[model samples]
Target: MKGEHILPLSQSGSARNTHIEDHLDGSSAAIKVIVFGGLDGILTMFAVVSGCAGAAISPLQTICVTLGTLLASAFSMAYGEFISCKAERDYVESERLREEREVEEKPEMEKKEMLDIYTNRYKFSSADAHDLVELTFRNKDFFLRHMMAEELGILLTEDDMTPVKKGLVMFGSFCILGSFPLIGFIGNFLGESGSDTSRIIGFTTTALFSVIGAMSLGYFKGSYMRQRRMISALMMALNGVVVGFISYLSGLVLMTLFPEASI
Candidate 1:
């Protein structure tokens, strides 16, 4: 029994599902990767950049801090996202194995459950329910897949997106999207001879990039669900505002605590 239960699920890992982009919800993972990654990168770098500037730290030190943030945050977000998505996938796979066991042990009960679902939730007539259920029953693979989807809302993975891939997606997008805010600072650092104007450019440029990314995400998510677009944009922008406030406040505190230290 245990061996049978484990076999199907174990094999599913190797099974190819379908295209990820076939469904509207397909881009959810990527959106999260981009939005959150961009927002976090912008806000954090903005704060550090501000704090370093406030402390009157040299441009070299500021770059060091900003660059360090880019690397550290990207790695952290990638690892964390990988773990999160993988955990959910693992849970669903485990449940699938359990369901397979139940279906094998009690085929009649499983069939009846499907019949009930179709008739009650889907409003399928009795005749249709019987035919549908019977069709699923004759094929163990289809039966398991149907049961998992209809009853559990757990569809087979639509794509071969592994945790590693998801992580890389996040890491790559995050580094790129998040780098927007740092662009001005970097540009000034490279173009100007270390001056107050360069510092001004750094913060201002960071703000502009952060705003663009945050607002774009807001609009995308809002419109994605056919929701009130304005509300969605405002809400997403609010997240950036909160993060920025906190970052700025932290920088302020840092500057306050060490008036003499050039950190």
Candidate 2:
């Protein structure tokens, strides 16, 4: 989502980095996580619900299957996210510890490395790079930070969310957004158990809900990423339609294979 900038020589790289960071700061990160989780939830549930509806299964059966899928998917998504994020955090910590030892044991070597980075990579004059490195070395923490960023290419910053928090967000988003398409299935509980009219209504409601959810996700994504909202919306809607159609076809195939299994 970022483009190359033609910056003047006078501009500091740190300033440009700060501006780039702003795009993902504040509510942006949470928004991103929520959108990601919500979209996954909606699409997955749509697949299941549409599949069941296409198979002409009993409402109770559809409800049972959808619920099972929803809970299973949510837990899976949350746990996977937690482990992935924790691993990343651990790796970063390991790097930090290694860098800390180098800073403490070989201060001069670290200083020279940082000086070379500034002079060569950042295009700082030799004298300026020397002064900057000298100034950084005055503070142990600052030196380590610069080493992490300049030498190791890892920027140290506090995250707004922890791994646990991210997982919880994913679980919540998946459960909530995924429930939308289930509404139609729930309607079957209101009418005669296996009536074709009720089943049709339920499937139609589920399809409508899926479309709305997909479009909403697309709109939010486009707005945050500064893309064309209409195009994004259409793209996401198309995905929903394709998934739903494929799911329906799969259900038809399954039904044909096991005619005796129809409830």
Candidate 3:
């Protein structure tokens, strides 16, 4: 059955690394979701910490806000990814079942539809379409498999952990990445006596992380090293600017609210 073939492809991999590679290459949508989610979390937390520092808030306050934001963002992102992936899986499954029914009840019509799909996709002539259809339909099951794999590109069965696993990975990765800047803040603040030194350390750490992430993503996508470096630097700089602006605004509000505070 088509389901048998499809199921193998879906589950073909070592359990340990399948999810990791899948998130990297399964669908562009999944990759983008994870990348952007991490980027946003990092930027958001960086800005919050910077703002607190700007407002002259104590190290303790900064740590509290950064940790709070990290936790909240991670949970929200994870849950959102879970729901979205589940919906996609459900839609794919529903379509597979519909295709299965069509194959059972209207074999000839389904064959014609499959031919048309391939014909339009590959731009084949009428004679070629008929020839191709005949060749594909030699085994009834083969024809259905071709239609499912080529025309629909949806599988009959999938890993139970697909969406939930992906969500957890994305959220956890983001939280970990985001915490870098905050950790920098804590280290600088606790280790150094001067606020200025701490702020510099925090900003440098944030920028470094952004550059590294961008370069990694670009390299994985097979872009030129020089171009990727430039792109990464630009993205990091842009992130810094946006976060800096937010932090400035937040600092203003914080300072107004806490007149007794050093800020």
Candidate 4:
């Protein structure tokens, strides 16, 4: 799964924060929703606004297009996440059942597999590996679960990867963080009508805001992923830049095709 993200089973944090999460039941999945949804919201709206401004599209049209895109994207993200998560859980369960059956029907084969894995993959001594496998196989359920977790990278608990929860978080966070770009437009409409600011100025300001949004996501990423703050921030900002430039080029190409539209 190229470009796909995998959540870790464990994350380190301050003792106080760990205790807080223990009580609150926080999931690393939430970090995915917040970081991705937040970044998408800010970046997409900013790009659309910048593109509309570049094309000299009317303010009213800009509002319509931006809002349309945001609303559609929000829905898509939420529903898509829900479906994907559900599918993932189903697939994992299906595989778990298959593994369970295999372990039950072919205990010796599985023991050998476990022994080989421990010895070859993990470099455990042959005697130790055999003993470990024997101990593990004492409980059928535990043996199956351990095999899946260790060999297949399955999350045994899956306490946090709820589809509905992830979907709602994605949609809600996207809406909340996505509104930043629109805030500027809203301010304009509330005051003296949105004046025709220079395209360069508008794009510059919008890009800066988008970069800030990206950095915010990156901060969350660093906190959750236990990575360096500056690197994550710069990487996110770089992604935003790529999106913005692509959008800008698209606008230019459209303007070139329909020269009269820019009129």
Predicted model with the maximum lDDT: 2
Of 1 and 4, which scores higher on TM-score?
4
Q: Give the whole-model CA lDDT for all candidates, comma-separated.
A: 0.73, 0.81, 0.66, 0.76
The TM-score-based order of candidates, best leading, equals 2, 4, 1, 3
Model 1, 1-263: lDDT tens digits are: 11111123443433444442355435655665666776676666666776666566777787888898889999999999899877777777788888889998998999899999999999999999999999878989889977887776665645445678878987887788677667877877787766777677766776676767677767877776668888887776677667766766676688788777644
TM-score of 2: 0.82
Q: What is the Cα root-mean-square deviation between model 2 and the actual structure?
A: 5.5
Give lDDT: candidate 1, residue 219: 83
Better of 2 and 3 by TM-score: 2
Question: If scored against the real structure, what TM-score would every candidate get?
Answer: 0.71, 0.82, 0.68, 0.81
Per-residue accuracy of model 2 over 1-263 as CA lDDT, tens digit each: 01111223333354458765565555554676788888899999999988987788777888889899999999999999889777777777888888899888988888888888898888999999999988878998878866776665666665667778889999999999899888756764666566777778788888899889889889988988789998998899899999999999999899999999987
Q: State the RMSD for candidate 3.
A: 6.7
Q: Which digits, one per residue and each the tens of the lDDT, describe model 4 over residues 78-154?
A: 99989988887777777777888899898899899899999998999999999999998999887986787667766
What are the RMSDs of all candidates, in order?
6.7, 5.5, 6.7, 4.9
Candidate 4 Cα outliers beyond 4 Å, as residue runs? 1-25, 123-125, 193-195, 198-205
Candidate with better TM-score, 3 vs 4: 4
